[model samples]
Target: MAFVALSEAEKVYIVHGVQEDLRMDGRGCEDYRCVEVETDVVSNTSGSARVKLGHTDILVGVKAEMGTPKLEKPNEGYLEFFVDCSANAAPEFEGRGGDDLGTEIANTLYRIFNNKSSIDLKSLCINPREHCWILYVDVLLLECGGNLFDAISIAVKAALFNTRIPRVRVLEDEEGLKDIELSDDPYDCIQLSVENVPCIVTLCKIGYRHVVDATLQEEACSLASLLVSVTSKGVVTCMRKAGKGSLDPESIFEMMEVRLVLGRCLDLAGSAGCLLPPWSHCGNSPH
Candidate 1:
């Protein structure tokens, strides 16, 4: 994660703001920064999206390729995640320095969709145990402001929703040989149902209250943070803890209350013809 150094007095100022449910940027404790989303922004990809939250910029591209299913789950396909933090994104990302953060983010993304229900993996299967479509989700950290996980998550969900995998058919010959056929029509492709795809919401525990989308300054004041992966249906697919500070059961429970807010917000966005996963819901409290 990218970080910014802050003095003792500066930390106290941000902490005081969070405790009063007012942040330096005028957002509430549970409010997120205004997020900008752009979809289908890249060529030669099955799907692509760019998300900007505060100073954070993330670009995600999903590529669909045919490969054999895994041995453990022969009838289902899987998603592969790769994260790249360019040197220009942050000073700490120079050369191989950002490898650790990239690997950590990629691993977290894997845990987010490590189940069958997250995606219809069965739909990608052309022949049971023989072949399936593998989705390669590549993430590029164009810039690092704060709340890296949340920004990347939103970009990934948007890309997955935009993915269009070519439909394939199996042709079995008389000699018990099977061949795969691809659709000639460009538009003859299948899209994954993103209704169950999860989005990550990072809440930083600052002072006595928790704040969503904590900027670098706010992060310097935070004692701990929670990463919540929630679906549009309010399901928690994964949870992760960050920072050296420890959180009690009460704090964890309080943070979990935020899980539903993201789901409801997404529902409203869909109804309003918005394709992006807007993480903030104004006038809502997570208490």
Candidate 2:
């Protein structure tokens, strides 16, 4: 994470504005910046998408490859995430730098999609215990204004939606030999059902209030933030706490009570009471 150095006066100004529910960007506490998503941006890959939120830009690509299924989940396929922060995005990402930050974001993504309901893994399976499709998801950070986690999540969802794995059939001979054949039709492919794919929403604690989609300056003024992954159906699949400050019980509950309607979080609602669960906590900021 590239740190934005802000003076004490500037921090005070940003915090005061957040307390008044008016951010410097003219957004409310729960408001998010305009999101632009473009899918199938890469022709060589199976699926790809580009997302821009304010000044932050993210690109995600999904490549489907045949491989053996994991031992434990023999009947399902899995996704592998890799993040690359361009040196041009920020000075801190130069050379071998920002590797830690990329790994942190990748780990957070792995946690959010670890559940069985997040994706239909069974659909990716080509055989009961032998073969399956391994989706290699690669994320590239073109620019970093702030709110990297949220932007990456949105890009990933769009890329997965655009993904279409080629159809293959297995033929067995009487001598117990098996042969695999690929479909001749280019349109013959499997579309992944991303209905349950959750998006990460970040809430930064500023002064006494929390805000979503904080810019670099706004994030520098905050002490800590909470990351919550919620699906289209309002089901929470993952939660993570990050920052160097301590979060109280009340604030944690407030972050979990975010109401998501049609992909927009309007305000806090009581229906999320049953969705909160214990999650892993980290000391580094993933912004």
Candidate 3:
């Protein structure tokens, strides 16, 4: 995200407020903006979710396809993350304009999921190296408000939780020919275990203090921000520094502590309150 210009006086005011544990929006240092999450919002995908955090809007779709397993992990399936910054979000994203930003965000997601702790790829496999389910997690940015990473991660987690992959069995005869058979009941399916899926929390360093989930206006007043990905169990998976200005090592350590604390809150609230599985909701899309 590009930085916006803020007057010197405004910057000083924001910094002073942060030193007092307050912000322009009245949220404390660790408080997050209101989050709205809806599952199965799109019809074509096997699972989908839309999350709106303040002004940042993100949509995630999961499509399961059968494909050959990778050589390194022949017994496991994997996830492909694609981030599309749609023109609908902003006129700046028209045509291929958003390609650069999209690629950057997609790469971050790939790195975050590189560890086995993030997702159970082996469970997605149907038949060792012969057959496996590849989940294509496509994320669409509907708005470019500040804190895009955090919103996108939340949406992705919700969509995966909503995914229901149908049960398929392969039948082999004495001749060694294989036949794929779908489950007798269409409703019988498997759900991905997203208990370890991580959520990205962005902390913008404004003035002398930092804040989480900063809006675009607030982001404009800040110099740099830290991106931290944390799992539902409060485990930190990835961390990176974003934006223009540099951050001190001591401040970075302080921000990490705050990120972990806030991450736990978001995980508990989002999973229990907003991230409902499709079966639990009777397959009805949360419009």
Candidate 4:
């Protein structure tokens, strides 16, 4: 997360605005900033996407690589998440400075998608305990204003939506050795079902109110925040409290209510309209 220095008076002003349901940017407490999403941004990757939320920019690429299946889940494939906080986002993120934050964000992503309901891993398997497709989702942070988690999660989901894995066949010879062959036709691929993929929504608690998709300035005024990941059907897959301030039980519940509504809205909006392919309008590329 990028740091923003705010004076006491400036913090009070922002907090007052939130209390009145009019944030600094004129959005309601539950409103989000303008978001731009583009799919297949990187040509070499199996899937890629770029998402800009406010001034925060993120690029996500997913590469499907063949690997042996895990012993515990031999019939299923898996997702590996890696987040790189580039120095371009902030000078403080240079070299090893941003490693801790990147690790934290990556762990959060893992927790959010740590369920069978989120993805059909079995569909990625070629043979039980033998071979499977491993999707390596890599996130690159280009800029940071605020709402880093939300933007990254959105970008990841969009990248997954755009991903296509080549169809492969396993053949056994007379010696009982199996050989894998990739499909010759590029169009002959499998697309992952992203309907159940969850998007994260982070709510920043300011004064007596909480705001969604807060700006960098607004974040400086907030003492605590909540992160909630919800599926398209409004099912919360993971929830966690972040920041230094502690919230009472009642406040926690209140935040959960707000998270539910905002999460559902995000899911519907993202899945229904925001994630359209880049060439859908220009008719230049095949979807």
Per-model TM against the reference? 0.93, 0.90, 0.90, 0.93
Which of the two candidates, 1 or 3, achieves a greater TM-score against the reference?
A: 1
**For residues 139-228, could you state the per-residue lDDT of candidate 3 as single tens digits?**
999887778988888888888888989899889999999988878785899888788888898988987788887877788787799999
Top candidate when judged by lDDT against the true structure: 4
Which pairs, if any, clash in model 2?
A: none
Query: Candidate 1 — which pairs collide?
Result: none
What's the CA error at residue 201 for candidate 3, in Å? 1.3
Runs in model 2 deviating more than 4 A are 262-287
Order of models, best TM-score first? 1, 4, 2, 3
Poorest lDDT segment (10 consecutive residues) of candidate 1: 267-276
Off by over 4 Å in 4: 269-287
RMSD of 1: 2.4
Candidate 1 lDDT by residue in tens digits, 126-187? 89888999999999999988989888877888888889999898999999999999999999
Q: What's each prediction's clash count?
A: 0, 0, 0, 0
lDDT of 2 by residue, 92-197 (tens): 9999898999999999989988988978999888887899999999999999999998888888888888898999998999998888898988899998877778
Q: Between 3 and 4, whose lDDT is larger?
A: 4
